[model samples]
Target: MDKDLNSIVQKALLGDKKALESVVEEVKDLIYNLSLKMLLFPEDAQDATQEILVRIITHLSTFQGKSTFKTWVYKVATNYLLTEKSKKDRKAKEVSFDEYANQIDTGQSAMIRYTNNEGEIGLLEEEVKVSCTHGLLHCLNPANRLIYVLGDVLDLNSKEAAEILEITPSSFRKQLSRSRERIKNFLTAKCGLVNPNNSCRCKRKIDFLIDSKMIDPHALRFANHTKRSIDMMQKIEFLDKTLSVFRSVPIIGAPNGIMKEVRQTINSITF
Candidate 1:
């Protein structure tokens, strides 16, 4: 946290209504993006973001200044995501590496009769790549998924991520390493983006995904963004080149109108 946000937090704690709203504005993107990665759905991410923001406001006084406010916010968000009952209730069915590989392999013979324009094809391919990689994260249990998202995608250092996760830095590093290796192995074996010889190209999957209604050509979820997650990340030394495929995933903004909803919800609360 910077001096401005720290000062805002102080004012918010003193019953400054504008400062409270400022706090929400400042942290909403972090909370929202983390929720999206954890939940793998925009609607669920939005709902969880709202709930987490409310929790932060309700517990603002509990912040002891032991860590940066950003880290503290991460602690609150991760705790809710880890323990929330509805997360399990709403989670998509888990797919194993074998099952996913089979799914990709099953549709390889299909022809791309939909579009021939190179630009449109590229967009659809991007959608497939982003959607497929996000789905891959579900193969890991929630804990490991969170570990990967925090350590690799968000590029948080081991000590900070460990503090956020309430684990020792060594344990965090161990789990993150395992998660990275698992994802890297799977991608290298199956994804053309990571391995040129792999048969599972994003362009190859575009037709099947569209035909099956897994992707909407008009309403793309991940491909429309101008900035990828990699643009915001600092390069990790000795990272496997294969994992760069994940870093290519687009960084999506929180859904529109979320701040309005948050403001309304804040108004309803006494504090």
Candidate 2:
């Protein structure tokens, strides 16, 4: 931790509103991106962002600063999100998949293909765009998405994120793997972008853009496999026997019930 970080946190903990705001600004992107990836919806991401900051304010006094300030801050955010996830219903009504699909029409696809280079900075076309949302971020589920955001976007290692989320490193790896598998399958199947087998580079992405058709077989297979897998995973006898490690411990930051009020909350808080 930088020496000055301690001072900032100390002031924030003491209710210096500016100090608290500064802290919020410092970690805003991390919180927003993590929320976006985990919830896979724009509105949810916005809500999570606001809720996280409010949580930080509520818990600021309790922050002991034992570890790096960033880690400690993240730990608080993770705990708050986990608490929200365990709830039965959400503040915002859950959006049906049908409603979401209706928004991502083919005309939007043509626009995105020509405009956003999938949000990669240098890869953006000659004319830049104001990103309306994390369009691709919503492609994740609660389980696997965190790992991708923490590891890939934020550049945090598995161990650090695990520490923040309070899960074992191995569980982190498994979740990350599952998250990647699901996303890779989704991109290939849904948007028809990304072919993992053909080459390491994203040549397959172009194929999807050019062909304008869904050619991914795994999407069909996944649709079939998901139901049985969920049922099988729920059966204590088998799920416990196989997923012994991930089963026993409390899921430090299980998904936030993947909610809807999520949008309202984010819009309220994010700077």
Best by lDDT: 1
The TM-score that candidate 1 achieves is: 0.89
Report the C-alpha lDDT of model 1 over 173-213, residue by residue, as the tens digit.
Answer: 99999988888888888877567788776777877788889
lDDT of candidates 1 onward, in order? 0.80, 0.47
Clashes of each: 0, 9
* Model 2 Cα lDDT, one tens digit per residue, 1-271: 3567677878766656576666665666667656544554445656676777667766666777667878886776666555674262253233333443343332232233433444331232101110111234344543344566675446578889888877898888788777555444443434311232322122223233234433232222112211222222245453212231112211123134432343343335433
**Each prediction's TM-score against the native?**
0.89, 0.51
Candidate 1 local distance difference test against the native: 0.80
Q: Cα deviation of 25 in candidate 2 (Å)?
A: 2.3
Tell me how far candidate 1 lies from the true structure as C-alpha RMSD in angstroms.
2.8
Instruction: Please list all clashing residue pairs in model 2, or write none if there are none.
Output: 40-138, 43-263, 46-266, 47-262, 47-265, 47-266, 85-256, 92-260, 92-261
Top candidate on TM-score is: 1
